[model samples]
Each structure stands twice: as structure tokens, then as C-alpha cells.
Target: MALDALGSPAAARDGMLDVTRDGRPSARIHVTSRGGEGRALVLVHGAGVDGSFFGGLASAFAGRRVVTYDRRGCGVSSDALDGDWSLDAQAADLAAIIRKAGAPADVVAHSLGSLVAMRALELAPGLMRRLVLIEPPLFVGLDPADPVFQNLVRAGQALAKGHTSTLFMLALERENMGDAIRPFTQDELAFRERDVQTHADHEAGWMLAYKPDLARIRAQGVPVLLCMSERSASTYHARNQDFLARGMGADLMRLPGGHNAPRDYPDEVATRLSTWL
Candidate 1:
């Protein structure tokens, strides 16, 4: 786990891993390895979207082996659609990938992916060196009957029902994104459209609860940095941030964009995370 400062960009190595779960071919994860090995940095994406959205951000960490891969049943990964799709399952998948990348790897995850990353931490605490979580809605300190939770359910349903625009709006509102979304770029709209088919797999994660023992994480000396922004001022976000900062001794980083900061402001997030790393 000898980590060096971020260096120049290296050529990417792309491959697909035949990763297994329950002694079966559960996933064929499409992995992209950017830069060369110094410290392995694994980027875990949230629901509905794939690893492709992380291209811009991964490039910033040039030689530090920025690894981005689609989770099971999302993007090009195999659809183990029958089994449990909860955070626990996702954590197992993450553990396999982290083991592939080598131990004590640095992980940077966003949204739902952050939840999976933390679950993996619980499952294999020694597998990770540190974590950079971007607006992970852990739903720990928040009420079950809260409006944000309701909106998230709605967003998931909207995504399942092919209501793409409605899903987008609900996602923004859930993250407390302001009045902007007027004209989505071609790339922006296209990404959502492409993810529509994969929404069913992600929607299941919404039902899962995240109740990590913060003291244990802190005791392990595994540093966790929770990154959010002014725009991501939802109650869910605030509660989790409070829990992590107060309970886990985790660091809080307020970035410039919303919960989707990793995709929206990859360069800025990368710059901040690189310096922090």
C-alpha cells in the first residue's frame, strides 16, 4: 500500500473479468485500467449508470491505476438478476474486484456505489486503504417516512416505467438540485436513456438499509472522506454526513456540484481527491 502522488497519464488497459459468485458465473465485469500501478484506485459507480460515465474523472489520476468497472447487472456486466441484488451482494462483487486489484486498494465511490463500497468495507475491512465517497445516501440517520426516501422510490419506479425525464427530475430533487436541468446535452440525455434498461437491477438496492458501525470503521483506522456539495443539501445527505463526521471520525469535503458531482464535475472532484489521496 505504498501510495505515491498522482503522476502523468498512462495508456488505459481494458478487459473483461469472468468474476463468479456462489460458484457460478455471476458477472463478467467490463474493467478499464487507466494509468500504471502505483496505488490501485478503484472507482465504483452508482445505480442506473455504468463505468463509462467515469472516463473524464479517471483520466486525472494518470499513473495511479484508476480502475473503473460496471457492477453486476449494470452496463456490460452479467445480469445475475435472479439472486439478491442488495448491498451485501454488491459488496461481494466489490470484494472480488478489489482482491483482483490487490489489497488495501483506495476506493472512490458515488451514490449507491458508495453504499456498496462501505458494505465491502464491513465484509473485508483490510481490503481497502481509504475511501472517497461522493454523496453516498447511506440512509442511516434518516427517517424511513422521509420525503427524500419517498422521492427515491418514485425515482426508481419512474426509471422502471420508462419515464426517463421524470426519473431525472426526481433524482435531481432527491439530491436537492436547484432549478437548472432546462436543456440536457446530447450526452446527458443519451446516458439516461441507455441506463433505462438497467434500472430494474438498481431499483432493488433502494430497499436495502445501510447501518454501518461507524466506531468500528474508525477503530480500523480506515479513513473515509465523505464528499458532498451545497446543492446536495437533502435531509438524507445531511444526516449521513453528520453520522459519518460525528460517529466515524470521517472527513467531510464540500465540493462544487450536486450528488452527481463525480459525473458533473469529474475534473474538479479528481483534483480535490488526488490532492487528498
Candidate 2:
């Protein structure tokens, strides 16, 4: 289980298969190495999306032993996990993954996973050497008074009604539809549908329950790079990224494409991240 050989399909980067919490019927953990000798760098995906969302960044850091896995109820992970399903739960899952893999490595988390990673650092301050977050949704939290919250609630309700296909269609038409969604691959569609369904239900509970605990994350004293899309300039995502950057006292960098840049333009995202890496 040397750190360099972490890409075997049959085993995780650490050559171990440890299930931390398993009350769900289909709970599983996946870990793969992108290749490197130093401490492993783990990538945690955002809400609705699975670990594949980091395709671009993953490929970019192929030289490093990068690990990315689906969170509970998303993608290959189980949806039947009990309890509140808050960020803390995800953070605990991450801590387990880290422990199973080894201990204390860098982490690159996106959106919802960023919140989870932040909480992980709070629970175990030595869990990560550094952090890279892209467009975390925690800045605004869940504003019940905001129209976006209403829209999310409505969308969740629709997906709960078995309207994932319809929701996927709207997402394709309205969203930028990165390579991950183009030409409508069945696998991609199925994955997207799962993400939509997950977000539409109990997964939303984790997102909506997030409260900014900036002091806790700062206390970890880890170097953090906050990133967002250059195209998000005109959108509220820009303001949100700025808010998160200021709140976390981290550097903010911009990448090409919109919110789905990691899928649409992984090369470019990887190029920008190389400077930091």
C-alpha cells in the first residue's frame, strides 16, 4: 500500500476497503490515485454531482495521487444513510476515507463538498494539508426569503415526483451543458438524473442546513485557494465567490467557462491550477 501505487481498480489508493458507516443497503467507497509519491490529494464533488465532476481537475493533477469518490446517496454511493445527512455527516465520511487511505493529505473540494471539507477540518484539524475550493454554495446558506430557495424547493418537489428526466432537460437547456452533458450520453444522463433526484430530496437537507463557520475553518490554518468561473462575472456566483473568499480569508482565482468549467474546460482549469499546485 505504498502511496505511489494508489490507482488499482480493485483497491483504493491505500489498497484498503473500509466502510466507515453502513446502515444503507448500497453504501460503497471508491478511491483511485492520479499518480504521485507525496501525500494523497483527495477531491470531493459538489451537491447533486458525483466525483466525475472533477474530470478536468482530476486529469490535470494526474501526476499526483488524487482520490475522488461519490458521496452518500449520490452516484455510486448509497442514498439510504440515516439521520440528518448534514455537512458534518459528509465530513465524518471524509475523515474515515482519509484514515483508511492513510492520514493528513491535501484536499480539493467543490461546492457542497467544500462545506463538508471545511467541517472535516473543524472535526479533525490535521486531516488536510491544504484546500482548494471552487464556488462553494455556503456563502448565502439557505435564504428562505430568497427566490432561489423557492425555485430550489419547487425543483426538488418536481424531482421527487419522478420528474428527473424533465429536470435534466431544463438543466441542459438552461445550464451551460458542459461536455458532461453534451449529446446526451445515457451514462451521463443517468448520472445527472441521480444527482437531480438526490438534490431534490434529503440531500437538500445537508445543503440548506449549512451555516458558515468561518472561524472554525480559519483556525485550521490551512492554505486555501478559492476558485470560480470567469464567465460567472455577471452572475451572483461572482458575488458569492467573493463573499466566500473574504469570509474564509483565502485567495480567489478565476477559471474559464461558467459554473461547470471543470467539465467544459478541464484543460484550462488545470492550467490555472498548475500555478498553485
Candidate 3:
């Protein structure tokens, strides 16, 4: 999809929903099923953000079953004020969603969710028919002092300051946030601010432990399709994603725009999946 083509029309219709699981935090899964005979697809959001991150892309896949949800402590999910949230714990939450929703599923995950989904496969080997990972910031074996790591730390801290909507707008002035935040409310900036604060601690924990999941995913030998934005070439993170694509033997596909490809080019992503899947 062209950047302008992605508007409120493609944004996800979201709500609070839950699922059952044993000895684990109750799963808070969200759904956006447009109904098609294609493989059931589960969409997982990134760290510091909720299931709503997939709103645009999920809507684009209107002909297929698309499920998106908050990880523990974000969006409508339970806040882990003081509890467990290892990568495995997150994976267990995902497993519950897949089993409850039933099978022949393709799991599409972005950023941090990509790592969690990879771990979920170890918990249940055949849980998914395919895996689509969008730009996971996996930095295993890379220098922590690398510019990319430093940039992430800086961005996380800025996001932690609770100015997300404004900051997001400033960072990507071309994006039409006016439409994107509509289902959210006229004061959607406030909602973004609250969402940012909701996961502060979880974000911190995830950021500190982020690097090693790359090896974990690579060692698992799961079928994966890693996507990068066409503009990813300009940044270290995108280059890192290219490195990950090479290491995982995963398909290195490109969407129309930059880092926020899902949001920026929902239609293109949808079209790509239509052909790729």
C-alpha cells in the first residue's frame, strides 16, 4: 500500500477479549477476523506496544482470520505488576491463543513478538503452519555498544516519557495519525500516552534481555519469513534485520516503505501475503 492509501479504513476494529490457560496469566487475545479459507493467521504485537499495533495490517487481511492481542501488561491484558514474564512465559500465552482459536495457523509476529513466537514453537512444535516475522530486533552476538543498541535505548527512553503520539507524529510527519487514532477517540494522543506508560517496566525488562533471542530462534529451525522495509537500508536496525534474515535462512522480503511498514504500507503487506502465503 502507498503511504497515503493506509488510512482509518484499514485500521483494526479492536476490543477486550480473553482465553484460558493453566498455571499462566490468563490470555487476553483480540480478534479481527474477516473470514476467508486461507490458513488461520495469528498476529502478535511487539514489546512496549499492544496488539493494536497490528490493527492496520490485520484489517488488510480481511479475507482471512486474523487474531491480535496484548502481551501481559499491555493494552487490555493483565499488568504484571510483580510477576513472571520470561520469553517462555510470553510464548505460553501465545500457545494458549493458538490452541483456543484452533489450528492450521500461520503466526505473523512483529518486533519483540517475533522472538516470543519463536519460543512458543519450542513449547509446541507444530503450533503453526508458517511464521512471518516483521523486523525483529534480535541482536545476539552483536556488540551491546553498537550504534543500533544505543539508538534503541534512546528511543525506548523517549517512548517511556509518555509522549508517544506526539513523538510518533514528529518522527513520521507523513503518517496520518488523525485517521489512525480515530477508533481510539479524538483525544487519542492521551490514549497513546497511557498505553506507553502501561508497559514501562515490561519494556525495560524486555529491552535489557533482548539480544540473545536471535540464537534461540535460529537454533529452533522453524519455518520463518522475515520482512524488512525497502527503506531499511538507511538504518542500522534494518541492516541488523538483514543480518538476521541471512542467519535464519529466512526469506528477506521487502515492503514499500520504512521501519513502520505494517502501519505505513498495510495494503502492500496484505498484497504481499496474498501472494506469499
Report the number of the highest-TM-score candidate: 1
Worst 10 residues of 2 by lDDT: 8-17
In model 2, how large is the Cα lDDT of residue 168? 42
- The candidate that wins on lDDT is 1
CA error at residue 250 for candidate 3, angstroms? 0.7
Model 1 spans > 4 angstroms off:
1-10, 143-172, 176-194, 205-208
TM-score (C-alpha) between model 3 and the true structure = 0.73
Whole-model Cα lDDT of every candidate shown, in order: 0.71, 0.65, 0.62
Q: Write the per-residue lDDT of candidate 3 for residues 1-277, one digit (tens) a residue.
A: 1111111123334444454455544545444443344456788876556666666787788677677766776665665533665676678778866765566478888766777887787667667888888776565634568765555555555666865554333333322221232254232233455456644544544543554445556666667788876766645446476567766667867776666667666777889966766
> Per-residue lDDT for 67-156 in model 2, tens only?
777777777666544644566667877887777556777887776787888888888888787788877655264446655455556654
The C-alpha stretches of model 2 lying farther than 4 A from their native spots are: 1-17, 21-27, 80-84, 141-187
Candidate 2 C-alpha error for residue 114, in Å: 1.5
Q: What digit string (tens of lDDT, one per residue) describes model 1 on residues 1-277?
A: 1111122234576667765666776656667777776668999987767787687778776667888887777666666644655667778878877777777899999877887887788777799899988877666666668888777678767767767678767766655542343344453455564455555445433533467777777777788898877676654787567866877788888887666667667677788888777
Candidate ranking under lDDT, highest first, comes to 1, 2, 3
